[model samples]
Target: MGIIKLTNIRVYAYHGCLVEEGKIGSDYRVDVSVKANLQPSAGTDNLKDTVDYVHINRIVKEEMAIRSKLLEHVSKRILDRIFNEIPIAEEATVEVSKINPPIGGNVEMVTIEMTLHRHNHKQQSEL
Candidate 1:
């Protein structure tokens, strides 16, 4: 088992609990960690054997484009997409940070992080 990390992907998106935030939008930074069997891809150097990071990035971007009321929802969407679309991924962690959040005070950002295991997620949901 090996880990693939993609960090600090910046995106401008409209996602917030507040109405103004959704209207104006804000900058967001996303980080994703994927755990999988990377040995085959490492040896064969084939894109098909491993998770395509470019495809993951595209997923993140696509999810960010949609409006959400909370960062937690955004992160969940990203994690779900990664696990469902990337067959090689056994687990995934996603972090979504809203830069300069509108908290009416001095705050740099707020981030939501979620981790999901393929087997546990399905079982937990069914219960």
Candidate 2:
């Protein structure tokens, strides 16, 4: 197994519980990591056989564009799409950070992280 990571994807998005936050928006940083079997691609040297980072980046950008009340909601949406769209991805973790969040205090950022495994998703569906 191997992992592909896309880090520090910056975007301007409107995602927060505050009304002012929705209108004014804020800066966000997103990171996504996906695990998959890399032996096939390593041997074949073919893009089709591996988890493509470009595809992953596209997913992050698309999901982050949507408005949500909380970072957790956006993080879950990103994970769900990764598994649904990238069939080769066995597991994925996403971190969504709100830079200079409005929670009051000297905080650098507020981040929400979520991890999902393909098997875990299957089990949830069966339930």
Candidate 3:
């Protein structure tokens, strides 16, 4: 199986459990990985054999706007949304990180990283 990786996708939004965090928001970076067979794309030089990035961006933007109390839930929502929407993808993983969160400390950033895997018949998207 071949894999396509998308990294360092950035978004600024209101996503956090803290009151000020939600009100002010912050910068978030997301990384995603997709696993699927790339035989046709590799052989024919056609885009249809691979996943589309525009669709992925749309899903990420839509999900991030929904708001969440925790980064973990937001991360899960991203993974699930792509899995449910994209047909050719077999597995997906999402990692979300917040830079300079409103923690009032010297810490660089707080991160919520998760890797989710799905088989052909298993569909779990209810966020």
Candidate 4:
């Protein structure tokens, strides 16, 4: 098994609980860790044999572009999209961080992380 980690992917997107947040937008950071079998790709050095992180990153970017009301929703969407796109991934950990969240205090960021296993995800899809 091999892990593909994409960290601190910065994106400017409109996502928040408040109306102003969606209007002005804020910076967000996404981190994704994908676990998969790398034996085939390792031996063949073929892109198709492993998870294409470039495409994964692109999917993240595209999903981030869509405005959402909550971080949890966005994070789940990302995980779902990743699982749908990368069938070979055995498990995925996704984190979505909202930079400097709009609270009445000083906060660096508010983050939500979720992990999904392919088998369970597949079962969910089947139902």
RMSD of each: 1.2, 1.0, 2.4, 0.9
Candidate 2, run of 10 with poorest lDDT: 118-127
Window of ten residues with lowest summed lDDT in model 1? 118-127
Stretches > 4 Å off in candidate 2? none
Clash pairs for candidate 4: none
Error of 4 at 118 (Å): 0.5
**Alpha carbon lDDT of each predicted model:** 0.92, 0.92, 0.80, 0.92
Better of 2 and 3 by lDDT: 2
Per-residue lDDT over 17-122 for candidate 1, one digit per residue giving the tens place of the 0 to 100 score: 8889888999999999999999999999999999889999999999999999988988988988887789889999999999988888998988899999989767
In each prediction, how many residue pairs overlap at the backbone (N, C-alpha, C within less than 3 A)? 0, 0, 0, 0
Tens digits of per-residue lDDT, candidate 4, 1-127, equal 9999999999999998799998999999999999999899999999999999998899899999999998888888888988888878999999999999889899999899999899888898889
The ten-residue window of minimal lDDT in model 4 covers: 70-79
Model 2: how far is 28 from its true place, Å? 0.6
What's model 1's overall lDDT? 0.92
